[model samples]
Target: MAATIEMPATRRPIVVAPMAGGPSTPDLVVAAGEAGALGMLAAGYKRPADLIAEIADVRERFTGPFGVNLFVPADASCAPERVDSDSAATGVADAEGRDRADRVAVEAFRDLLVQAAPDVHVPTPDWHDRDHYEDKLDIVEAARVAVVSFTFGCPQPHVVERLHEAGICVLVTVTTEEEAHTAVAAGADALVVQGYEAGGHRGTHRVTDAPNQLDHLALLPMMTDVGVPLIAAGGITTAGDTRRALGAGAVAVQAGTTFLLADEAGTTAATRMGLTDPRLGSCVTRAFSGRPARGLRNGFVDRFDALAPAVYPAVDQLTKPLRARAAQRGDIDGVSIWAGAGWRAAREAPAADIVDSLTP
Candidate 1:
């Protein structure tokens, strides 16, 4: 059955992009509501208990509508122990990328391991996609979050059905028309049409497929009547861009770069600094997490992935300590500063101040 929600014609029209790892927080969510935009708290990379806390926090602060983005875990059935202490797990490097390394990367990784005690064995990441989905769903529904979204791809039918049953609005991020159709068929309440120029990770369902670079303007009408509300994302860096998206058929627009430097954002100083500097122009690479994500081009992405395996949370885990250390030493060259092409438009200010750029 098709799902439905009680959206008004004059609903505040902007949706905040959920950035993981500190950038998207409860404060950010409240600011989105305060600014008359819908904020989405990132549930990615956080434990279920932690996500619950954040949902509660946002509920306490904002009575208005908001969304929570879930990183739908993939169904790869590989054993997590395969890469544990596996030295072959060493990341592969590239020729042009080797020169980009700053001195602090490896040392930073080493020091953090000493403290976090990431197993001396270094097992591949223990991935449980369904577990994360179910646990998070319980929290979002309990909190009665107004909106819920999925990334990397839409979920199975049953999963989508459950969210709808809870009276929550669900949106899925898609990079292509195929995914757009797939999401609608699976019962998504809306679609977040992510374009190529957008930054951070591309939400292509099949990890191996080359990402579609169709800009939002071109892709928008191409979707033609997807039979659901369209919430456009990717590459929207300014108010003009937002207007264009809605003009092209989007019910609302979403953006990520502006939050890169928001005071409430958990972005590290290294990232905040690099994103603003022109010398650190961004590039997409599958190095750090074995997925093609756009970030401030760095030595780490340049060198690795020459032989980096396609394993995900595994690759993500192997490099966590390395990234943590580099960030600690203020090494922007080695850290991943995921930003959209609009990093140039990002402002270092409060979240409420940042979303004002997108306010209608």
Candidate 2:
């Protein structure tokens, strides 16, 4: 593989998108640096303590540049605005059958949440105000990490500025033009424009806001409004996809789904085994995290989409145990198997081989 990359140190454009709940391991981050691409340690699911340990481990192996990807804890989801009426939301029922159906769905959903979380990912440090956001930032700053990227939502302006003052470049993942604009206004150094095909959760700024209905090709053109260096992510499975995104005006392309099965990645045996099944394709479900994310479709999601609320961290916690139990038993019915549209393109060689092949 020609491991040649055309970007300079300051403009080291290619990024290995951080996939939480396994693939974003310390060794993988080191591999990215060796492969001539930047890597982000997925902070989306880790406790600050666990994340700190991983950060230290990466530093132990690779003294060069790397990044930390956090999930910006939404101010409101952890403490949602009171709903004035239940009739307007997901579980309004006028008929007995409808009521019964909703109840059955709710129980199934509880089961789904538990099943989905099996050592599954968390959206943030657990929740806002309590997720220890400040401490995590301070710890990463102490490590002198080169970049701090965020998903789920944009951090407060002051938080971004603080990391910037610490000399850390801040990149926020955005799924829509509106989000990109907001991130820029809030002090993002770069924008990770995530199109719908992105494997994990789409980082729509508003948890309530519906994700934009654009494919990568259509979405690529609209990112021009962001006014920052664009790094397109999601559904990039081949060298051709990479070429297309860069040609479409992305300064660099970010990838996650491609690394799900990489040798150095932390992907679980269940995910790797299920990927080869051919029966489990990808679909978006709010079952694991309160947010809608794409993952392998199985018995769990087949049973629980309608009852899963838009409410995130709460659902994330409520279902954690079940997901854990499922994974322990190697049951695909309950574990969250995140993947992108390019699942078929996933390879089994070492992450270094995969990374070297991707760069131009």
Candidate 3:
């Protein structure tokens, strides 16, 4: 285990959750640090070189402690079975049949996308892509930032050992008590206790499992015995929310939706409009990413939520171009506007001011 390094939350008790796909930026990270809070750079969708550049940028501008968050790729065993040539030739009605069914579902969804967004270029699903997991691991280890966090699954014990060897603290996001225990057994230094109310992905270990609808406050106390530092996440927006989480035994509180409107955030105009629009409500759906995430309800979600498969990066990749085009056109009905349950409280401000407001 790493020699009991101090958690950044021990200093300020406020952490900016790493919002991947644009909202998290170097300026946001610096602003969080400037306000005596910890900010994390999201590494989910970036290339290793891009992650390296972002790390260098943050280091150059802000000397205070920060962190990088990575998505642990889903294991091959969890993936849908691939259709083999023999199976296709034989027309087998067992495992191969199931694989074929899965493929059909994905293709049907693609057809729907093509029909709805004729101008957008939808690509074929990359079933085997691991989101460059190995390369990003190397980059993060070399960077030796103050902290590193993992979502989607717990890192293997050896991976944790290696990060500890490099003098880095490791945190894993977990949505349940069982997950918290698993992460601790895997040598995670702390657990980011994510509730169903959290914006973006649910951080469940298995891609296919539906995340439980436990609110962060209701879930935090259940994890108090896990013997690691606890960071509360999910819909935390106000000073009252922060204090309640800390009182529930969280060493800190991590907020994502609250910072969506920050000046430094890379949130698109469509997402901004969705956040403030009273007509747009929020719900958890797999329509956009194939993994259950909470975002503003829109026409795309209404059209595709029930049809989206459980395959993640595959579904995420398939919808990427369409979402980009939607954002470019500033069409709120077509983009994923991720926000927490307390999204109504979000307001435009400097990240430092936002951090200060959330600080209890």
Best by TM-score: 3
lDDT of each: 0.74, 0.74, 0.87
Q: On a 0 to 100 scale, what is the lDDT of residue 194 in model 1?
A: 87
Per-residue CA lDDT of model 3 for 1-360, tens digit only, reads: 556455754357999999998999999999999889999999998998999999999999988899999998866122223345566556456555656776787888888888887878899887678989889889989989889999998888788888888888999999978788888888889899998889998998877778999988888889999889899999899888899999999989999999999999998889999998989888999999889999889999999999899777778888989888888889898899889888998899999888888888
Those runs of model 1 whose alpha carbons end farther than 4 Å from true positions after fitting are: 6-11, 76-123, 127-131
TM-score of each model, in listed order: 0.84, 0.83, 0.92
Q: What's every prediction's RMSD, in angstroms?
A: 8.2, 7.3, 4.2
Each model's number of backbone clashes? 7, 7, 0
Off by over 4 Å in 3: 1-4, 76-101
lDDT of 2: 0.74
Question: What C-alpha root-mean-square deviation, in Å, does candidate 1 show against the real structure?
Answer: 8.2
